[model samples]
Target: MCAEALALLRQQEPWFVSLAILGALYVAAVAYRLLHTSGLALCLRGPKDLRRRYGAWAVVTGPTSGIGRSMALELARRGLNLVLVGRDPGALQDIAGTASDTHGVLTKTVQFDFSLVSTPQGEEAMGRLRQAVERLEVGVLVNNAGVATPHATYLHEADAEAWVRMIRVNLWAVTEVTAAVLPGMVERGRGAVVNIGSGAAEALPSYPLYSVYAATKRYVSQFSRSLCVEYRGKGIDVQCQAPLYVDTKMVTNMVTRGGLLSRLIMPTSDAYAGAAARWIGHRRPVCMPNLGHRLQWCLCHFVPDRALAAHRLRENLRQRAVFQLLRSSSGEGIGGRR
Candidate 1:
């Protein structure tokens, strides 16, 4: 029996050794590719003509705060004149002033509530934006305005009106705004449209409250890709920047009492802005800011649904525990129940 076992082990040893070698080579190749194919490299290799063609004028929606504000600032730094759009006239003025003073670039402010646009009032607001763009020799459009409601247990239990509002803001506004500007871009034969999207488009399950928001963002991603395909030959670039939880007022409020999963995944608005600038400059179709986010999304595409759900449940519980600990340290009770 012992002799037979030794023979079996000897036969399997060569096969095991070959498998190990093959795995090592595969890992080395992947590592090499990662080190070489960075975001910066992609940007550097993009069309030099793109920069020369886009000119100075750019239109950015939701420029008062978060990633939109950052993108507007970044573009200004690159010498692009801006048409800054937002809800509050005062906030828009402040941002426009800052950009003008700091970047020494021309800035225009258009105040319109994206949430109110389905009504006559909304149409009026969009009219203001359209008029503002027509006067400016705008060459780039950043479709960045969006909103998400607080988390609810289930779709039926959620506020239907609020969900519809999210859809209108997150998806409809993008479509309308893009449509407004696209003909001019297409006729000009050179332009770029950068659409801001959420990582939830990958269908991550932790933020059950954001189901409608996620679905809307998925539309943004898919539509952006399709638009790119349609216009690629016409010299129009449509790109999507799908970032994870950004450090902004909206995210801060969402995760203020949120679970541990939120803490682990949340990134700063600055990160999103920087990455998006790179994506916009390069005209990449899709850009996920961080490597961890990229990995999670890639895995989501390949993992089994049941296994993914189990992992998400565990992550949610872990996030909840961390939130509880932070609350307790601040002399608050668990579950934020007080």
Candidate 2:
């Protein structure tokens, strides 16, 4: 056996050497790509650099909480003034005040709900938003306002109104808000639009129970890609940052029920905001800033879609059970966003 193996090795020596060379080339290519990406991150490290590239004023939708709040604060810390939009007037005012005092930047709060954009109420809000931004040198627009289903719900189980509201918040708002801001970015000749997406769309092969939410995010990712190609020549940078779970009210209930592995994988909203802010002006059209999320995205290519979907269904069912239990216990609001 040893002599036979020795003869085989000798016969295949040239192929072995060629394989070694190919492996070395692949490693070198990967290293070079990583280095290039790091260099871009360092060069465009927000603060004054971002202010110069995009302008000094930014408009961030849904600036009152979670990732939206953190992104607004991060940008303000980088020297850009802010125009904050949210559904809650009081919360919007509070955020505006805090941003100004803490970051020492000017802030204007636009009180509007993205869910109402197709109605008469939305018209009044739209007019207000236009007036607020028309004269400013708005450099960055963060389309961060979004929603998920109140709980893990199947499409058939979800009410028509519920799905409509989700569509408005998750899909319609992203499109209309970008439309509202893109013309201004074009006129200015330089700007960034950062849309917040989810790992349900980018990192996973299939999301079972959260199908509609994932579908909406998939659209956002594609929209961002097309927008990048369309506006790159016009000096507009379009990016969709797809993060996995983050420590936010939207998933507070679900993650709590999702066990230690789930908790460990989630980034704090502040941490995610920092990465998202740093990567905005980089040329990546669709990206996941969290390292864990990026790893999961790579693994997904090797995973069978049916298996992934089954695993996701189990996770969602657990979340659904927990949410139902909590709602029944208190007959009141739980820890997640509706």
**Top candidate, metric TM-score:** 2
lDDT of 1 by residue, 1-338 (tens): 99996676677878886787699899999887665434546555643433367756889998888878888887887788999888889988998999999999999888877777688988998888888777556678998888865343357765678777777888988998898888777777878998888776654654453467778888999999899889989888888878776677555433443455553466566666656665664556777755446656766768777777776556545654564565668885322100
lDDT of 2 by residue, 1-338 (tens): 99996677677879896887699899999887765543444445533478988999999998889999999999999999999999999998998898999999999989888888888998898889988998898999998988885578778876788778778888888888888888888998999999888889987888877788899899999999999999999999999988888888888766653566664478788887877777777788998876656666767879888888889999999988887888799996453332
Note the Cα lDDT for every prediction shown.
0.73, 0.83
lDDT of 1: 0.73
Model 1 misplaced stretches (Cα beyond 4 Å): 1-40, 43-51, 203-207, 253-265, 281-283, 298-304, 311-338
Error of 2 at 300 (Å): 2.6
For candidate 2, the TM-score is 0.88
Candidate number achieving the greatest lDDT relative to the actual structure: 2
Per-structure clash totals for the candidates? 6, 0
Candidate 1 has its poorest 10 consecutive residues by lDDT at 329-338
